[model samples]
Target: YNIHPSEKLIQAFRKKPYQGCCPIQAEFLFIGLDANYAYDIEEQKIFPKVIEYHKDAISFWKKYNVHHPFLLDGYKGDGRKYHKEFSKIRLTCEDSSRISFIELLHLPTTGRNNLRNTDLDKNHLKYIHQAIVSQYTKAVFISDAVFRLMKKTSTFSWMQDAREIEGYSLKVFHETSPLIYKHLHFSTYGKFQAQKEKEMKAIHMIISKI
Candidate 1:
């Protein structure tokens, strides 16, 4: 009698779009993603999918002529965050083009009721840590940015690996820099959200501040 539902309930789980729903970060925050789940990037239509497997994505990025490798981290893995629930994409406009990195896995944004107390079981906690370590290694190897803003509230301090070195500053170097007021737009099924306007305005403010 649908005991399957109850059995699945007792087992551990990861939140999905079918669950409560995902909340995007505030308008001003930058976004980035890791490499593994890049296919999701195309499916989501967050941007045009770079083709030819690896070469095209890199080439499309280099097209802007602002090439620099940086470490990109996905989750802290300190029990404070769930890796699979928070898919991410990094956004930074440079040289007249928007730069992005696609990441998969993250904590659910839904409130406490959605979380399971068993999420902290030692095995579960270890798996989360392992995921973090693996992701961190890739980012470190590439020297991308961790996007610091996505870190869990406090379980562990989210720090970029020392090997990553310096990254681009939030402030644009040129007042007229193509990136200065570059607009990033988001749409859901051909319709735009009012939040997109706010994001644009906030970006302008950030540009003006720089």
Candidate 2:
């Protein structure tokens, strides 16, 4: 498979840097490091349909009809292992429409090790800001690496009073909105199975507080 995004998709990204179902006014936002696959013209072809289907958080998760290419496993039985772990926490709550997922870097690549800082320019930061603003996100679940990067930027500069939880950390600027939890990347959850329950509980606690 060609690992380069199509020109059309690249232009589309200049307007909307996020892939997958991102609902309007999402309560829970999960931010990943980067995309795992480069999107081609075929992927671009379905963008409109996907956007139409993802009208709101409730519609996006209704019967679990999520339509993201990377998250197709979610529509199947158990989904990917990391998604399964995310589901565990999501299931703890009643409103499914309040959850959403996005990435720090919209550019697609095979893995994080292959990515460079140059890939995350001003447009990417603007996209993140736009996502948070448009969605009115209540809480943000971020990977450790992405957290480190965002910390240097003004977007996450408001984050203060870091509290550690099961080897992960949670940062908050206020008593209520936009609780930012910094955790080990979901891809590494399987390797730390022994600590999974603890981490899940801690994450659930954060969700409940929000």
- Output the lDDT of residue 101, model 2: 68
Writing each residue's lDDT as its tens digit, candidate 2 over 57-116 gives 345455445433334432222124566566565452245555666666665444234444
Q: Write the per-residue lDDT of candidate 1 for residues 1-210, one digit (tens) a residue.
A: 011122221221232211110112111222222222222233332222222212333353345332221112321222122212121122332311222222222322222122223232344333433433432211110112232322332321443223211332222312321222222223221244444444445544443343
Shift in Å, residue 68, candidate 2: 5.5
lDDT of each: 0.26, 0.54
TM-score of 2: 0.64
Worst 10 residues of 1 by lDDT: 17-26
Off by over 4 Å in 1: 1-29, 32-49, 56-58, 61-98, 104-192, 204-210
**Model 2 lDDT vs. the true structure?**
0.54
